[model samples]
Target: MTDVTSAPRELRKGANVAIRDLGGELGGLTVFLDSRGHDGETIDADVSVLLLDASGKVRSSADFVFYNQPIALNGAVHLRDKLVPEPDSDEAAAGWSSDVVTLELDDVPQEIERIVVAASLDASTARTFGDAAGVRLRLQRSSDAADLLVFDIDDATTESALVFGEFYRRDEDWKIRAVGRGYQAGLAALVTEHGVDVSEEADEPEGPEAPAVDETPDEAPAPPGDAEQAPAPPMPAEVDDDTGTSSPATPAKRSVSVRRPTRAPRLPVDWNASIPADDGNDWQAARLFPVAGIGSGEEQERRATSALLAVMSMVREFGAALTGRCGAPRGTITTYIEVPFGQDEEAYRPDGVIQVRRGTREWTALVEVKTSTGRLNVEQIEKYVEIARARGYDAVITISNELAGGDADHPVAVDRRKLRKVSLHHLSWDQIRAEAVLAARHRGVSDATQAKVLEEFIRYMSHARSGMGGLGDMGPSWVKLRDAVKSKTARASDKATGEISARFDELIQHLGHHMTGLLGVEVQSLAPREAPDHASRRQQLADSGLMFGRLKVPGAVDVLVVGADLRADKASAAITIGAPRGDTRPLTRVNWLLRQLPDEAKDSIRIEAHMAGPRAVSTAALLGKARQDPSCLVPEEQREIKAFTISLEVPLGNKRAAGTGTLIGSVKGATTTFYADVVQHLRPWVAKVGSPSRAE
Candidate 1:
């Protein structure tokens, strides 16, 4: 392995470098397109990959992987979900949004000569790469998540599509080149150039149409001999359809049928069966992995490790979902508990070992487990990395209760030098449980027994005795910081204040992760647009006596804003949506929103109408009051309505624990209640077809 401590080589436009030159071998590599814009501008772009043959063209449509086709080549090339950094983390502070594409180089087919990584603006958004700042690509060795190369594209102008780089075959070796080329014609044209059949009619209904048939032949069919002697029906006369002029006939081209891969139907799980029935009996069903007698942290760790590993080995879908996130190729997975290893006369037994075998290749990782409130030890992790490196393992994975803030960074910082050959990764118990729920309940497990086993594992992990709790405490500084903030004496630079802020961010992240599992959709934590960095957010909290975070739930009308107001002793969740454009009367617009809410919402929700004009003030009214008059929320001056904000507030909890009357509980409860009662029911206003716009 090359010296990983060396600084990543920065490539200029059109520069080429070999993969071996940077990482010493061609293995699992990840391409990250980290994009940001100045002045809080959002760069809406999509990253895609094209696998090409020696002709520099895709072999088939299946070779293209993008938002629509996220995985291709049997998991050799996969476009991962967009990852947003925690609002207060360094990545978020720098305004970077990451889109990742993983490449299992060894798994790439022998016929594939090149892998191209490209990015393009979303067709719905009329924006170009020039609008973005610090648009760059980082190539990281997936095994260690270490950056080997970085390329910055500084000259993108009027271009909607860009080819950041490509990995191509070089004799018996693979090499990468920085190809910072741009296309103003956007994704379709760029992909077409690479031999993807760009079908504008792809969105149209599928299935073959019946051919027009003539029941009566125009004439008696010719005899077989006559037919054989007949010249092919005279070629249709060639003419310029646009100019009505004769033109030369051209040879017909062979049409290539590129069929999009069909996605398998997701089977539904019997969630009701998974839930235990309370019949007031002392008898309970026997579980595959029981969590009954866990008394110490060690016991909890052992049971959790054994149960999770065993399940991962049995359930194919669940295991792939988890291992794929750690950069392992799709393969047959085998997991073992308490794997023993020795290095330099020192013996070490990692909690588990995960080995994934694909064809002749095998990828292995050492796992360290921590249950309850056990924190990862820095020296312990460094030692494991050393052992993994000596043993030629690919990665060292740590599973614990501690939540990683941004970029899946480890809670404990280990020496960077030890991670050159072996990568280090962290997984929170909350994340593991969430993934399990998604796989078994949402994504579906094909085998009935495997699904049952996964469900059992989930039940065992959910048990309080298992000690795999999710985001339970706000840390020891919660009380003092809460008091100081309430009293208006918390300094921005105070150690306690920083701790509280960091923990609060973690709470918000965990909330999003939890919602993802429940809703079967990815929910993300976002920084308030006004405060882009942690320092500014801390200052904002110190000045306003409030901490604010936002959640971006897919398909929601708007990002949900959550606020914890220390001064007011309230926790609130709110969302703002634009008013219907065609409605002429304020009453109609007000009723438009009112009609979407359930009748019970009138009791606890508040509505605010934001009026147009620079100096216009928004009108506020409780939903119950607004239900009666509607005019209560309308401005007396009759300023045109611009938008409306619906919000719910609950008394903030003061304690630091997980259950009722605790700060974590209150925040989570408030967000969940707001979503269930309000956000879920509200739809974004869309202009109705054929509806006339009324003049103000």
Candidate 2:
């Protein structure tokens, strides 16, 4: 049974409480600032953190972590990527945007006595906190994602920045205090109060001001009118003894500057775009990591492991992207292959090992990898856990073809007792490929050679001979369960039914990762929070003869809901978005949505209008017919149209492999096609300025 915690304790302004009182001995906490702009306005509120000493001031400028300086105190505190509301969620409907600040409390330096969390508006904008609504903070335990407390800032006027709260050390424990303090001068004044040196550059009307400061603020300020600031002392570059490759040069410690980080210039060529199609006579380029000689599963695993580790070691951004997810500190990463270890009387050789060094502290994780259809061996993983624990390693990571759930659940089961000392994580080959693509294609690497190497790795992993094809098989029980459900003979407790349900969940999860890589945005699979467990999902499948999933694309007008219906032998993808506000005429609202979609979308898509009332009359029509007669979707009784749902249905495939006639391919194809044709083009209708707030 899920733990039913009471409502989060709301804290009034100036209220303080012990962190232990809310949740005892937390590994870490996450502060979420959910801010909403006034109707039709855009608010770009940025959240930041400050690590202060006993004197209530930062020891150095590095102690300030914000958008420009994201990491502080050796990764104990960092600013996460701006969070977009889940599509179709209440937050999305209400136009809420969230900024997250993560605190690895256990990793915070002992000298840090207080951690302050604050938010600031873009200085270039005239809007203030008064122009924002629903500005609140929710403190959550990062371990289980449970809300520990909530504070709503209801009192605000003309303030450009606000200090929402702070965590202070009390003896050996920590305590949180809600501080609803505001600053009228914006981010410059806000950070200046926290010991950051802000430059006095005249503000530009069109562009943001450059509030430059020396990296180490403790140094004497450079003379005014100096052309350039001093750079940090560079460390001697170290070459890896194993691969004979030069590692990124470490830099001397530096303080933070109150300035936006310079954005990288766009590359001359768009590496992400596809090259022009060529005739059969075109020359083929040689790859950095060739797959031509791969023969057996062992060779495949070895080559894949070596290739991944080598690329990670060479590419700084790619390495940080992967290791950061594993809770490693932001620093130098070194990887080794076939590391030998001993636990009790047995000797073990894991596929690879990863080590991260930040300052004098280091974290290590052992990696075990498998390719193709090979499943993880529980005993082998358990032995790795033992080795990691005995050797004081931080984690043991497993890579295989299997898919884990959206919640990072491991595919292989191991003894829970053995994992007390060493954490274990699993990464699917699909996920690894997605991350590689996201880094190389979407998020560019700084060094051109490193970028080329990452691109080559992506190509190598994508090749057919690499054996990294993801989600190709839906398991042997797929056909049996499909027939059973269609014939009305499937039971909730049947083994085949459960397996099919699990695979369907995996498919949805894979779709999220795949779309995220392709679109360069985070796409999350919305697992039913009420029925998140395996048993509940299996029961849901048996009862409805339908396996359903929803993908939440950030900033999308509506959630993309996909379903596979065994009874109907069809798969469908749909999106439901509210109709245009301030427009009462159903035809006008229908035309508003129609204008966003292309002419081709009318063929495969269906449009439905949801009307207001107790009964809530709903009328639907094919897009083609609706285009000719928009009134067909509007209720004759003249009820108010509340929303519209656009959907596309395709024949469900019956086979197991992800090919032309397979279930996996059909569902994936339907979703991507629908998104490209419909979802990507549709923007939520915002009311015009000076328009009536209510429907006519």
Candidate 1 differs from the real structure by a C-alpha RMSD in angstroms, to one decimal, of: 11.2
Worst 10 residues of 2 by lDDT: 217-226
The digit string of per-residue lDDT tens for model 1 on 517-546 reads 777666778743333477776776777778
TM-score between model 2 and native: 0.70
**How many angstroms is residue 163 displaced in model 1 relative to the true structure, after the best TM-score fit?**
15
| TM-score for each candidate, following the candidate numbering | 0.67, 0.70
User: For candidate 1, what is the total of clashing residue pairs?
Assistant: 1
**What C-alpha lDDT values do all the predictions have?**
0.75, 0.75
